[model samples]
Target chain A: MRKWILLLAVFLAACTTKPSFTSENVYVGTDGVSLAFTKNSPPAEVFENSIFPVGIEIWNKGAYNVEEGYALVNLDQDYMEPGEFTGSTSIFPSDASKLDFQLMGKSEISQQGDRDTIGLTVLTKPIDILSEKHTSTVSVMACYRYQTFASPNVCIDTDPFGIRENKKSCTVSDIPLTGGQGAPVAVTKVEVKMLPSKSQDKVVSQFRIYVKNMGNGQVVDASKVADACSSEGLTKSDINSVSVSAQLSNGIVLDCIPKREGNGGLEGYLRLKGEDYVLCNYEEGVPMELGTFKTTLNIALDYGYMHSISKDVTIRKSAVI
Target chain B: MEQKRVFLGVLVIVSLLIIGCSGSKGNQPTAVEFRTGSSGLDVTFPSGTPQQIFENDIDVRIPIQVENKGAFPQFDELSEFTGFLWVGGYDPNILQASFEQGDIRKQLDPEELEGRSSFNQQGGVVLESLILSVGDLPLGTAVYEPTLIFYLTYLYKSIASVPVCIDPEPRSINVKDKVCSLTDFRKIYSVAPQGGPVGITNVEEIITSNQIIFKFDLQNFGTGQVIARDLVSSNPNEGFDWRDLNRVQIEDVRLGDRSVDKCKPDLGEEVELFQGIGHFQCTLSVASIASAQAYTTPLTVTLTYGYAQSQFRNIKILEAIEI
Candidate 1:
């Protein structure tokens, strides 16, 4: 009887704990969806004018379920033609419009994420065999929508000058980060500063958040996820584009300013190319009376990521005349 | 193999340390740090200057103290052109300097006035004395007060040496592992700003394929007004205008011998500072660098601008009772 009572009490305590993505260790890792060429699927060598199949296995290592039409697989058309496969498709489509629909993500109950496969069976076009053979690289690209969320306890010192005699909870200093927040685009650091405002009496809380692309794929604009793998609508500007938003646990929304965007409050392109910083400030200046305290900073980065792996195959002329 | 990698890592780190230690090349630092203090000359009245004096007493003297609080006047660079100290904004006949010179128009030290540094925080100070005879209270029976302005003008230079990452091919076709490519290695190193009224506040380095651009934030980090090197004179009271307040000139911008060109606001134009804050952009050709990895190098920017400082003192003269 006593054992049962103790177990119920322990479970109740856990139920009351706050739901924090980082503290609770939910969907936490530096990696998102990863794709690789299945072993021996795309044979090492093939005969000219013959058909071959390219198989890729994608694993969703993150916690967000990828909806149908959200994950697109593309085939490199320069080397081979989808002769017998799904012919004449979207910008650069696979045998199917999208990968496996309703691909579930990692959950507490199911520790390991879902897995799916894509097959691009194509007919090799005749090529001029120089000497022994002509080798070609068959590349498969997987572009999918992903998000990176990081929640770290940050110091918000309203009384940075120590005007009051009361003891403070936290002090303001730069928060440096290592590893990553389980996304291709990761927040590297956050610089905390208490600046004097125009009024002189109030202190403005400003944070410089640094971000970088930490994946084996290319970053595409979140709005153009479908066309990322094909390079149809993707331009130089569209590449390396990421949307960013941040807020405090206390419901105080921050005004985020990217280097490219002069105005604050808007997102996207928060960083330039691979690395940059975004300047955000508490829209409402922290009053001096509140003293110092600690709060969780929730930073969200959204973007379309595409990873490609190619297998080289040597095609020998069937009948060398 | 592990030992080989460790040896290579140590070699790279040692090489970077050597590069960081190599400042401008020809010039070796005399002090621990150069950037310190805001005022070119910290002027104050130590002892000789008194607040009140009896009419016809004739024993009024003020020793004006001037300290080279900033790294300028460079005594050696200025030669004899350091500038002059003038006493204006008061009646000349009522109060004279030293009772012999008739007016206070004196040349500076004729010797070296060293600026402030980490080793010598107080810097070099020079004292100029003024012997005055308080005249008979304007012949009127009461107390008279006059606000005296001690004007100081000198040519000063503010130089900022910043460490920047130079990628040979900023926009290379294929990206690989480089020293400064990682965010952990790329951090803002806040060395002291070269000391003066006008200072380079922050530097933003942007790396693109063909070009390496830098945006430098300019600020008047001092309490005095910055005068254009050409416009700074002994007495700007009679000939000064609004145009002289925020004017500065870029003397030299270089990375060792290679000149950083394609600068915004041009090179020779009088760079006007808006408010206390202003900025300029300059680009370095990455084509010159043929290395695969990014290396750290020093970017030295020299700016020549004149600074004007004034300290005011109010004095009262009371009529002596006729015995």
Candidate 2:
């Protein structure tokens, strides 16, 4: 009897020791990113027929990694791309210019922060200005990918004798999983629960997923763009709009819809646990006589995001004329 | 010896005569210096002003004028003041002197003064007359020349302005010298930017016997978008039109201890500013036209408007200069 107990303990330890993957890198949205035109870089007072340098600065204020980050600037005809000027490069089509940069995430622990800058030289075109003054507007847009992470623990138990102290003492299995690969909406947590029914003697598994808005913009219903939450404003249609799903080890997939209140985007649809989450369940017809098994939970969330900034530019008649 | 004594006396007389002539020449009347007041106003009784009058005779009139010879320009509401003229010294039982028209309060008109007087184009002189009536004098009076004194009291004012540049992005450019003058850069002047759209650029004063007029330039210095208070909507879904959202209510316009009763603002109720920078020739009439010497009185202008200012300053936009 003692030998059997020893063997059981060893087996349980082996099954419950599931290997988990370390996620060192995550991509959230650019919400933590900031961009600006450095002071006096573009020459506050620019003269006509001469190339002036405009410097753009970028800072990453978030914890996630951002990739393929770039800024595009739109200006009026009063400015032109440098043709033969030094450090002259054009990244956009007519009426626009682009600047690329790389940055590291801001870390409170290591006290490490990421910031970078790019400079562009553009020719100033002469124009007739009455009252000796002229003003122009420049629009700037940044594009990049960001990510969010959520992780929740689930209890898995499968003991027919009703002799197991807890799921941790029972022989259990773990499967490594990763998602939010192709879409902007990503799921970070996948928790599972396996329990036995007293009367039917059947096994039921429940899955819970944690989701977040990892991008620089707010998450909203993919079907609604104009009505989505953004710097422009927020509406009731923006709440609990994320759709999540889970796939069990048996290949069965379950979906959890956010519980919402009223028709407004502000209340209802239970994603509000301080963290947005959804729950799904799967039940088997009969109890398993059994052995320790491995299971994988796959999650997916559907959402939409938006970001923007504006600057005023003043131009002077070039002294070159 | 008598001849010699007479000759000596004649010599002494000649020397005395010469000294007397020199003394008389030095004592002649020198020019009288008349210092102008800070309000740029000078009130004085012109020549032919009556010094005496026969008691109990109506239609006795006295003429007085106030000279606005200040360096600054005067407007109806800007530098306007009031004046009151009363005839004293004559016994009230024997004489009744007051504004001939029963309008003791003098509302000095700068425009009218400018048109009537040749003193200065910007500021001119305001003139008025006071009539006196007589009560029953001492029975069977043969001759009477009562010394009647004309006492004047008025409110006076002055105004000064300097240039200021409004810039949202200060670091992007050196705007200290970039803009010229605030008054010249913006074509229209408004006193109200977010609150009233009514900008009081300059102030003037005019004093009369019973009331004082404060003439000021109420302008729209900013974008003249004015919204009336009653027309304001509470719907969150509907966006606000900035031009229609600018309205300013005159909470209180006071001078010293008295409040102005008659102030004509173009909008009828609140001051409305629109069409870039609109302007109103506003007038404030106060009954505090008491008798006081040329002095400065506290004038308070309080306004309430849906004051909101949100504008992006392009460092490239140069300011305007009056020069």
Q: Of the candidates shown, which would achieve the greatest TM-score relative to the real structure?
A: 1
lDDT of 2 by residue, A1-321 (tens): 999999999999999999994322232332455767878766556655567676767776654455545556556665544432124344434323654445666432322347777676667666675424466555556654443322222223444344421111122333223443322444545555566765444566666665555444445554443333213434676543665545443235554544444443211134433456677766542233222223234344444333445565566664433
For model 2, what is the alpha-carbon lDDT of residue A185?
48
lDDT of each: 0.66, 0.44
Chain A TM value for model 2: 0.49
DockQ-based class of model 2: incorrect
Candidate 2 lDDT over B73-170, as tens digits, reads 33434444333343333223334556646643344554543321124433566677767665443311222233333333322222222122222222
TM-scores of all candidate predictions against the true structure: 0.43, 0.30
User: Which pairs clash in model 1?
Assistant: A29-A182, A30-A182, B48-B62, B49-B62, B171-B209
Scored against the true structure, residue B144 in model 1 reaches a CA lDDT of: 40
DockQ of each: 0.00, 0.00
Model 2, position A131, has a per-residue lDDT of: 26
